[model samples]
Target: MSISARRHTRMATVAIAGAAAVALALTGCAGPAEKPADGEPVEITFQSWVPNIDRAVDAFNAAHDDIHVTLETITAGPDGGYATMLSAVQAGNPADVVQLGYDAIPDFLINDALEDITPYVSDAKDLFVPWQWQTGVFGDKVYAIPQASGPLGQFYRADIFEELGIDYPKTWDEFYEAAKVIRASDPDRYIAAFAFNQAPWMIGLAQQGGANWFVPENDSWKVSIDGPETAQVAEFWQKLIDEDLVKIEADFSSEWNADIQNGDVVTWISGSWADAILRGTAPETSGKWAVGAMPQWKAGENVSATWAGGSANAVLKGSKHPEQAAEFAVWLNSHTDSVSILTEIGAGWPSIVDTAAIASLQDAPEVFEFYGGQDIWDVFAESDKAVDTSWSWPPLSSTLFASLTDNVKAAVDAGTPLVDAYAKTQADMVAALTERGISVD
Candidate 1:
């Protein structure tokens, strides 16, 4: 294998740089890493979106003398970081390790941007929670180590539910009714936002019932974005929107934040990671919020789904220190102390199950303070177990999401019909994939 040409000095930690500048800094292909002269360390550059994760790097630096990691933060995740990383890789300046979303793994693979870490991490497979760990495996080649996992749930205002003489809806039918009840109390209030812009959210809901929107055949890929289960999920949400029972808002916008703060959006269909976001956004709503099991297809059904999110550390193909990067990625995610620090910083649920990391999260009063000190981890932990394991992200996930977001969002904005948009999404997805020379079913 040809080594990357870029190399960094010992203990090199650069502040987040512009894409071109960072690419220039990381550009090079050196043969297998050579120990620095005068007993200097080998430096590994990491690009990620998680804040305060530097504590883990510091911990690793303190424990290991030969290897040092430097973390780089991106301005916008899932969109900006993925693009910049691709630019860096194409420019031959890729970081030694990059934090990538589980959904984005196939894109990186499609570009051949990740190094196969199977030789290093295949043995440690048993250490991580099974499904979370499997996110990095494609074509039986391990590309990365799981750093976090987020199981889906319905986060809602408990105080409001109590004031209105209602309980958390256990089924979508009940949720629709609860939405009416909530809306009836104050005509301006809404139960939740059915964001057509949120493709992952739609995909997650469909995944709850074993949606098979994506499939693969031989070396090519196939997509069925309008699969039956997905259509059912979409039709349900569409009814809520059509009835004006749910709000429609672009996420992370100021208006959305205002709705959340003012309780205009009383319920949020989100994942475990949103817990931290909720607390950070609505500190005044402290003790008023709670997480419940996801709304199911039928009442009294014990079921849930995983929104395709979370990130992992991958040894980039351009790295000259694949072995060192692989080892560091594994240790950063698996070492008990390191994982605890990550969990402490609210890095979502631990990828490694039943570890002190999860135990600490479950036991932390502050972690659950937003939920009136309830053990919401138990909700997410169980949800994680019940997730639809039949689903796997398609290699063209970005295209599929873009197709759904654009076409479906148009329908939502135009007041046409959401279910009808699914057909367009499927057609657009198939067309997009076909342009990429990927087979579409």
Candidate 2:
């Protein structure tokens, strides 16, 4: 939570412990392991934001009498409870297992606040999507259990395209063409809006072979948030704004919601979880929406990239019930029944490769009802496959999001060009990382 400048030793230093020591830490340190007495159970506290976590925890408690998990819901914070979780950890009274975003793992790990759970789920490596699995890992140790994945997908109005005689656009060029045609039809209506406040959209675009700001060095990190490919993305959007082809509006505001409901905003580029959002916000437009793939660089390419909103379950190292915590985390994330329940209830997209969970979503009448009876789960599932798994997030992802959002808003308001915003974001990112004793090559 504190970003004060401090002088330290090597910035990129990560101490790798032996597997035996890691196992001991996961089992409550080198002391004698505590076992529940004849009737007593090893209790572990789980802090989470998911509303349906009780369903899973109750099932777990009923099935296993030895390890009981008590669920606690924490109020959501602006930074997604990052600062609150750190404060708890610093106070030496952290929850045994906590809900965590994959992007924030590096920050917690850098502070040595998470427990290495590799010893418990070592053989469960092939249970999740390969890319989602990578989010839980730091160095050679696994610090978290992946619960959900967010792959980008585009949701558009089916009726609008039908009315305008425009088929779905496959390539960026056709998308641009569609934008021009649709926006010119009405003064108040536009194809879509490029919201400057949300940096996840920009991150998703950058992952589409446009640019990658962070690269892995030997033990350090290379910070380069600006490049020719990223500039290509910015320049394309800039042209759209310059020609008035797209609306530059604030995201998630009352105005934006009104635009969507009023048919002023037709197409939405976001992750799989957005299906729930569209259904919840504009029930008036029910059956008018349909899901599809995002526009790619090439006409035939099917590639897409991820945006915001994915979290993992991790155990804290200082907990007394580390083994029970690890077991509970693994079961909560990897169990087939739990996965099915979570996905069926619209708890984001499940990262686990549970066939039953996937089957529950595919062609299910309920999953397609909001999208005019179209099988949207299939579209999102395909997008998941097309995500670029090689992309990496910086350790200071929270700071990166804040800085990028501000820079992008400046670009939108002043028309000084998004490339300049990218430059400032890069410099700020470099300075912020270096100030935290992090190596930025």
Q: Write the per-residue lDDT of candidate 2 for residues 1-441, one digit (tens) a residue.
A: 111101001112322221222332222222235677889999889988776678988988998988989998875433756676777676667788998877777667666678788888778778876667777776556788888877888889889989999899888889899999899888987888998878888888877755767766555677778888888888888888899988888767899899998889999998777776677788889889998898888878888888753778888766777778888888877787777666665556788876554555754675587788998878877888887665666667788889998998987888799989999999998898766655567
Question: Against the hidden reference, what TM-scores do the models get?
Answer: 0.90, 0.88
- Superposition error at 412 for model 2 (Å): 1.6
Candidate 1 scores a C-alpha RMSD against the true structure in Å of 7.6
Deviation in Å, model 1, residue 315 alpha carbon = 1.0
Q: List the residue pairs that clash in candidate 2.
A: none
Q: Once superposed on the true structure, which residue ranges of model 2 sit more than 4 Å away at CA?
A: 1-38, 75-78, 356-359
Report the Cα RMSD per candidate.
7.6, 5.9
| Candidate 2, poorest ten consecutive residues by summed lDDT | 1-10
lDDT at position 126, candidate 1: 84
Against the reference, the lDDT scores of all candidates come to 0.75, 0.76
lDDT of 2 at 319: 75
